[model samples]
Target: MDSLTQFTLGAAVSALCLGKKLGPRKSALLGGILGTVPDLDVFLPFDNPVDAFVLHRGWTHSFFIHALATPVVGEILVRSIGALRESRARVWLTVFLCFTTHAIIDAMTVYGTRIFWPFDPDPVGVGSIFIIDPLYTVPLLIVVIWAFFSANWTSRFQSWLVAALIFSTSYMGLSIALQAHVENRAETIFADAGIDARNVFAIAGPFNTIVWKVIGQEDDRYHNLYISLFDEDDEQARVYTHPTRSDLTACLEGNDAFEKLRWFSRGYFGTALQGGKVVISDLRMGLTPSYVFRFAVAEYAAGNVRSIPPQAIEGQLTSLSDDLNWLADRFVGQPSVRAAEASGGEPYGTTETASCVERQTSG
Candidate 1:
């Protein structure tokens, strides 16, 4: 979720838990600050962007770490804030919930969150919702803002806060259900098309859950299928196939950046050789033509692969303006390409179907 959503959620939860004791303004401000504390890991230094990207939502987001640090944070707050001193248990509960809920809701997005940290570094990304969804955030933001400006924490204000929490939580649950339904439908579609895909997942597209992008992985390639909730039951999403280049991965066997990305994406990644540099793009994020994270982790020299420190690739969104237009049409159940025709590129990213090395050699 975006920072505003986190802030508002934290404020709402805090206000609900301790609004009467500390007053609405003070409790909301404290909770909002604490809510964003875990994400401070973003400021920590890393040798490479890939490490920074993959290691985010790491130890800071862990339940164990939160639990161990709760007493320390709670004690500090209880001692420093006179009002909280009288309500030790409530203060502790408020602190704990503020941290835990942040991590839990983050796990709902496609960007993975390592809530378990050291015990299980493997990211937990439900992919049920996009990072920013107005549908989910607006209600909570509205309620939290209302409480923040309220002169007193009245029963009506408290009731609205609780209602917002219930609505947002239910919306999260609904996203999970919608994801499952899309995945199941995608599996059936793949079977009908003889795709032989076993592992498949669905992610909400852009700002809405009505449009979904389903990716099904096979051995050498993966398929992307876009479907809309408003589409007719008989309407089938067109499948776009993209290569994974598992064979090229052997050359990068010992490369740290390569392995980290493979682990980070849970095997949904593709490789391309561009300008003699080996570029890897996380297939799970962005659409085909533009990915959020792309790194040149290795190079080709003298017909041999040479490992290089990961260098982050910048925007590949030459067709982003067009893609957004397509997304809007797709969101409403209208048939459209993922990328615009004027872009003259295949929807996912490129038109090339061959291995990276093959493309270079043939050229």
Candidate 2:
């Protein structure tokens, strides 16, 4: 999720926990700052672009690490902050909640977070919500702001903070339910089309949960669809099928960087050949022609593919305004053929090749 949402969430949880001792203003400020601590890993140096991309939200966001550090952080606060001196337990709870909630919410988005960390390095991504959702953040933000400027922690203010927390948590639950509903619908549609449902997954579209973008994978092809809750029961979703280029996977086998991406995407990925270079696209994010992470990892040479250091490719959005317009229309169940039409071109573009590895032919 975005930084603002995390800040507001931390503020709300912290204010609720320590308001009586520290006052709503001070508690909220402390919590908001602590909430952003886990994300500090973004500044850490890495050997390559792939490591930086996949290693974010790692150890710092781990639940185990947070649990182990909670007491240390709380003890420091209790000793240094006069008002919190006698409230060791509450301070601990505040620290734990602020850090854990930040990680939990981040895991809710399509971008993966390694909440479990060392015990389990695999990232957890529910893909139930977007990275930014105003509906989820606004209520928490409003209540936190009210509490921030309040003279004291009155009973009424406390109630408002609690209500906001409840509302936001419930909204998160709702998104999970909606994601399941969308996945179910997509499975049914896929089954009807003679496509397997084993690899089907749905993610909220952009900033809203009312509509979802679902993808179903097969060995050689993948299907994409947009479904809105407002659509009639009998309405048939427009499905767009694209090639997976699964055959090319063998060409880049044993390449460390390529394998890391395959693990990150959890098999929901595709291969592309652009100007004789091999590109890998994470199929889980962005639209059909545009993707969030595409890497040019290898290139064709004399009928063979040779591995190279990974280079992250910037996804091109031909028109942001037009894409948003389509999203708006699709969100309301207004079907259009634009997405289908947009699917008819080569999805990858040419990029400069990097140097490395022995040549290997595609099997």
Candidate 3:
């Protein structure tokens, strides 16, 4: 989830737990600040962009860390803040709830989070929601804004706050259910097509979960299938192929950072030659052709593969403008049938088959 969502969720959590005692204004402000503290790990230095990308949601977002910090933060607040001194235990409880809610909400997104920290450093992801969804954030933002402006009427704000939380939580559950339905359908479709793929997932596309990008992984290749809730039951998926490579497998396999990235992506990544460099792509995001999280993890020089510190070029890992319109159309404006028909039955973001473009090649 985006930072704004976390901030607003924290505000709701804080206000719900402390609004009656501390008033809405103080609770909202305090909660919003604490909500973002966990994400400050972004400033931590890393050897390369790949490393930073892989470990972005590590121990800092862990529930274990938040649980340990709660007492310290709570005690400091209880002593320093005059309003909270009388109710030390309640203020501590408020801090724990608001802080932990930030990390828990993060775990619900496709981007993984290390909620367990040292016990389990691997990111725990539900894949139930997109990283940023207006449906989940807008309602909570309204409640937070209302609390900030209005001084009194804490009880009334509390009612609306609870309502917004229920709605957002319910939406997350609905996304999970939709994912299951799409995966089951995708499984049947693959069987009919004779694609011997066992591990498959229906990932939400861009803004909404209704339109899913189903991926099936074999040994050295992945199959892409696009399905939408709006289309007829008989609508066939537009399948795309992406080939995996081991061009410099020996070197990349030995690198600790590369292994971490592989684990982070759940092995749904591949190598590509981009601008005469060994580039890695996280296949989960963007469309088939134009992916967002490309990184120049190594350089190829003099017909030899040389390991270089991974670097991400612009318009790859962080660009949103390129896919914004497509996401909007796929999610709301255009019907899925039109998109399937408009492509003339060809998979979008593909060149011939994935095999030709992504075949194994030497430097």
lDDT of 2 by residue, 1-363 (tens): 999999999999999998888888999999999899999999999877788888988999999999999999999999999999988998999999999999999999988999998999999999999999999999999988997797588999988899889998999999999999898888888888777756789998888898788988877677778888888762557777777665466767777778888999888887777666688888878886688888877876555678777788776566777777877877777875544235543455432233334543321
By lDDT: ranked, best first: 2, 1, 3
Query: What C-alpha lDDT values do all the predictions have?
Result: 0.82, 0.83, 0.72
Give the clashing pairs for model 3.
Answer: 289-349, 292-316
Tell me each candidate's TM-score.
0.92, 0.93, 0.86
Q: Write down the TM-score for model 3.
A: 0.86
Where is model 2 more than 4 Å wrong at Cα?
A: 340-346, 349-363
Give me the candidate number with maximum TM-score: 2
lDDT of 3 by residue, 1-363 (tens): 788998998888888877776678888888888888889999999877777888888888888888899899999988988878898888888788877778887887767889998998788777767888888889999999998987775566778999998999898789889989888989888888878876687778766777788878877667777777765663455566656655444446555555666889887776665565666677676565456677765555544555566678543332355345545555543533333223432222222222112222221
lDDT of 1 by residue, 99-156 (tens): 9899999999988999998898798999999999999999989987787787677898
Q: Candidate 1: which pairs clash?
A: 288-348, 288-349, 289-348, 289-349
Answer with 2 or 3, whichever has the higher TM-score: 2
Candidate 3 regions with alpha-carbon error over 4 angstroms? 248-251, 301-304, 315-363
TM-score for candidate 1, please give it.
0.92
Task: Provide backbone clash counts, one per model.
Answer: 4, 0, 2
